[model samples]
Target: MARYNHPEWHPLFAGYASGPTPLTTGSYGQLLYVTEFDGAPKIISEYFPEILEPAPPMLWSHAQGAEINGIGNPNEVRALTAPTFGEHLDDWNEIKISSS
Candidate 1:
């Protein structure tokens, strides 16, 4: 039930936890992705009713860039393409960050 305040995507920066859901069933962050191409971010994760906030209209996030930075993703510059296993992820921004 911990929350990390991501500077770039505050408020909408979904939480990542042991499982999929965040703190509880109703207090979880949704898997969201963003690319600067069209300036329109896309919801990569399946629609979760318990999601904290519905993806906002015209909402832009640096999630993609964050992932690219964290993982050394080669496809960081492109929206449609993701590096390797990233293609399988529901949320391109979803990363297994080390709990350091």
Candidate 2:
């Protein structure tokens, strides 16, 4: 299992990697739509346990207004309310440019 350094509700600034888990069984294949001030990335993992399924989506929404300026301080990411996808993922802060 991968341990997160910050709270699950906190926004993510950088680093786009799957959490620790087995990829063969698809136990951690849950999808996460992480949105940060920089951009948004969809992370899919198959190693994590099913009990932790809620983390990915929550983390994705929590990273709305999070910004990693130049200094090393994690700021609070604000939440947005739009009417496109769903109520949970309405207003997103960052927009994705590429897939690499």
Candidate 3:
């Protein structure tokens, strides 16, 4: 499973090696921090039963910005808040990423 067409979340911009489930298809709209640990990290825009409702409104991505541009995040900003990790994930947890 290797897909990366994230031109502004195009086609759900997914590159999961072995993670995202719950009918991980994607092709509607939003979906930020998607984790499959059966826990937190969820900014949905519909990822249930294959995209449904409307939970879209979580942006802020300058390719993981923060280096001279931190004024309320200015690169597709709109992410009020919903990203936390200090220990909490276990259920198919084997996070690995590479795009080079």
Candidate 3 residues lying further than 4 Å off, grouped into runs, are 1-45, 48-82, 87-96
Models ranked on lDDT: 1, 2, 3
lDDT of 1: 0.30
Alpha carbon lDDT of residue 45, candidate 3? 28
Compare the candidates by TM-score and give the number of the best one: 1
Q: Relative to the unseen true structure, what is the C-alpha lDDT of residue 64 in candidate 1, on a scale of 0 to 100? A: 33
Per-residue lDDT tens digits of candidate 3, residues 1-100?
2223343533222221212344322222232333222443333222211223222222223333212121221122221222222111111122211222
Off by over 4 Å in 2: 1-13, 23-59, 63-100
Ranking by TM-score: 1, 2, 3
Tell me the TM-score of model 3: 0.16
What digit string (tens of lDDT, one per residue) describes model 2 on residues 1-100?
Answer: 1112245423433332233445323222232324333355434222222443343232332333333232223343332222132321321222221111
**Higher-ranked by lDDT: 1 or 3:** 1
Q: Superposing all C-alpha atoms, what RMSD in Å does each candidate have to the true structure?
A: 14.4, 13.4, 15.8
Separately for all candidates shown, the number of backbone clashes (residues 3 or more apart, or on different chains) is 0, 9, 0
Model 3 lDDT-worst window of ten: 85-94
Any runs in candidate 1 off by more than 4 Å, and if so which?
A: 1-25, 44-100
Taking the tens digit of each residue's C-alpha lDDT, what string does model 1 give over 66-90?
4412222122122333323222233
